[model samples]
Target: MKKETLFIAFSTQKGGMGKTALTVLMASQLHYTKGYHIGIVDCDYPQHSIGEMRKRDTDLVMKDEYFKLQAYRQFSTLGIKAYPIKECTADKAIDMAEELMQTSDKDFDIIFFDLPGTLNSPGVILTLASMDYVFTPVSADRVVLESTLQYATMLNDNLIVPQKGNLKGLYLFWNMVDGREKTPLYKAYEKVIAELRLNMLKTILPDSKRFRREVSDQRKSVFRSTLLPADKTLLKGSNIEELANEICQTIKLENHGNQ
Candidate 1:
């Protein structure tokens, strides 16, 4: 039997919301730490940041002794190579993913798409509609919140409620939360979101520069990488593990096994 693969995306109408970073982090965590086979379709068109990151990660692993040793140990022990990242336009993303699933030697549990940030991009709506689950990152900013709410409302009204596509759930989660921010602001937004009846994730990611770091020769431990799972030490207090756990539970994904 062909493996059943979940199509998921971390997306938002607004840009610089950490969608790409979250995608790579979650994919890495689930694939390496949780032993789930993974694939990534980089559909951000002109940028293809995830695909580029993969190239840079590969280079770093080759040049850096620490990263090289880590990669060797990981692959040697797991008996699996790094997950594949395919690049394509928004319109061709689904087709590319399907082809990848059919052709890949390993059975994938999930295939993530890093989509274009703007809705004006060709096939953005179509791609978003096709996901089994869509997770949007929101912040405390007024403009970001407004844009996200409008975009979420549009998806809820047009695709989700009408059952137009494969979308099973649309989730919004707080991202880039600062400890210094007033509590009342978050409470107010939570009340508003509740009134709007949108699904919100319980896990909120705190603002940290670590999210921007990937496989680099300068860093002693990796926080984010396309080839390796995050270092266990860095996961403490990061809440990324919590977010991953919640997402897996929400999606009804079985643990399968872990390395």
Candidate 2:
């Protein structure tokens, strides 16, 4: 039987919601920890943040003895190199991914797209419409919440309802949660979201400076890297692991990890 691959994206209209960070984190976690094959399409063109980060990670791993040794040990143990990250425009993202699937030596279990922040960009909507699932990272802020709800509603109503594309599910997850903030605010948002009939992941990621930390010679262990899975110790309390598991289960992905 032919293997099935799911195309997913972490997207939202507004920036600074940890979309790219979560994309890398989840891809790394699922690939390294859960033993899944993952690929990333950096469709957030121009900056291509994920692609640039992969380049910087390559440089740091080459120069830093700690990261270099870590990479070597991981590859030797896993018997696989780091997952691939491809860069392209939004419009060509689907075609690019299909090409990768055909050309790659190993079959990918999931292909994630890191998309541009604005929907106004050409092909952004098309790219999103093609995804099997789109998980939007949202916060408790008023402006961000409003924008996210509107964006999700538009997609749900226009593309999803009309069955225009391959999109199967649209989910919203709470990211960067500040414990100090009042609980009532979140409850209110939950009420509104429930009334709006939006699907939400049960896992809520906490606000942590670690999310901003990337591969560096100065650090002993990496928190985020396109080439390396996050250190298990660093992942504690971040809820990233839970989030990954939740997404996989929600998508009903069969666990095909080599482990």
Candidate 3:
């Protein structure tokens, strides 16, 4: 495992499924709590959701007490930053990514790629294989899950991830999960979970209005207690952050052991 470079590509071959939200949340969590020097290469330029997200984040920090209040009066203390990577050609993307990895600041610990959703995009295949891990966020619906499963299948058919000394699988996780009781949507989610447990992480990000509200106005995750309460129903767990910790620890394990 590359200690400092846990690169994750958040893509689902489908749009409006909370891919941006999950990527931003994971990046923020890594930066704020675990202290990872993180970089987001927003491949979706012109429609740069991640870059605009960073702006919203800075804006939120200026107005809200959600983020850490630095001793300095300026609200520029948050370290999360984003840059727009050019077109989706595999060679160009791979080269740019490698250069960023090597030349990044000493504090940089993780890198995230916000890839465009379409698999037919010029460089998506290479981008998918290049990642050490992947977080594919699918909503609890059939069309969303079907589109996501296809990407997993595509990645599996072509990529060989070197984990430890052996090849391993890519990690997958469900996002925008609605805690419905045995509904059709829930059943659909269950099917994918059974098929990809090895690739899946156990933590679930429940669907919540807070996620939408913050994304619209605040433009960051609602993880910290200052922005959201520990037991906030919007997050919908015993504790709001309880599931988030599950994801970090699960990914930090020695290996997935399935592949």
Candidate 4:
């Protein structure tokens, strides 16, 4: 029998670090390419990017035909069948997770939870405890990596360790990186990562217009667009899809070690 793996939550104590984007990217990957049964729990209420993007991600999807093919033509072929849940407490979130487990997700191989960027949320601790791993996205800035480190400390200090499971560092990756000369922020961050010796992902998403346009103008992807201004001004650089692909590889390789 195939063992059940419930979910993994992507979180960071700070905002503007690409948490939602990565969460959506991973869900897209697991469903479209890897052929895993997947579900997404969008805990970012009111203005949930995951839900908003899901509602409008079709344009971008069409642009990136490869990923689009993975999503296929089905309505919600990504396999995420639930609507966004609004709650702050761990008890509430866990209760929702338990309820979801009773539904059609019995065959699901993975579930992705897109969490809001807040430490005080009621589900923060419970969500962290329930996950197989928490993938934190960090920017190439001293402040962002420092904030990431601080949250790691909080997980160590505040969270009640689950007797039957454990959470481990998945490493921080630099997102929205510009391919120009290293900014002072990058230099400062290097020293901090060296001192803490925190694990960092090998992939770095270069700062590019494609990402900005995809988010800003509601374009589905950098590769797919008809607007001349958006096409010319928005996607002028190397694609970041490759970096997201590495994240997929990391997810597979990491889980491979468990078996």
Best by the TM-score measure? 2
Q: Report the poorest 10 consecutive residues by lDDT, candidate 1.
A: 250-259
Tens-digit lDDT track of model 4 for 98-210: 56656763555566777767867765666777776677767756677678888865664444233434464445667777778566766677667667655667666676544
lDDT at 193 for candidate 2?
95
Candidate 3 worst ten-residue window by lDDT: 223-232
lDDT of 3 by residue, 1-259 (tens): 4454566666777888767766666565445444455666777644777666556655765676534353132225543243223233433565766777777544345567788778777876667777766766666676777777777766765565333321245656666666764566555666756775436666566666555555323344444321222223444552226544665565573331111
List the candidate 4 regions with Cα displacement exceeding 4 Å.
57-91, 156-165, 183-188, 212-245, 248-259
Q: Write the per-residue lDDT of candidate 2 for residues 135-165, one digit (tens) a residue.
A: 9999999999999999999989887888999
- Clash number by candidate, in order: 0, 0, 0, 7
Clashes of 2: 0
Residue pairs whose backbone atoms clash in candidate 1: none
Better of 2 and 4 by lDDT: 2
TM-score of each: 0.97, 0.98, 0.70, 0.69
**Which stretches of candidate 1 lie above 4 Å from their native place?**
none
In candidate 4, how many Å is residue 141 off?
Answer: 2.5
Please give the ranking of all candidate structures by TM-score, highest first, separated by commas.
Answer: 2, 1, 3, 4
lDDT of each: 0.91, 0.92, 0.56, 0.57
Judged by lDDT, which candidate is best?
Answer: 2
Q: Write the per-residue lDDT of candidate 1 for residues 70-173, one digit (tens) a residue.
A: 88998897675799999999999999999999898777889999999999999999998899999999999999999999999899889999999999999999
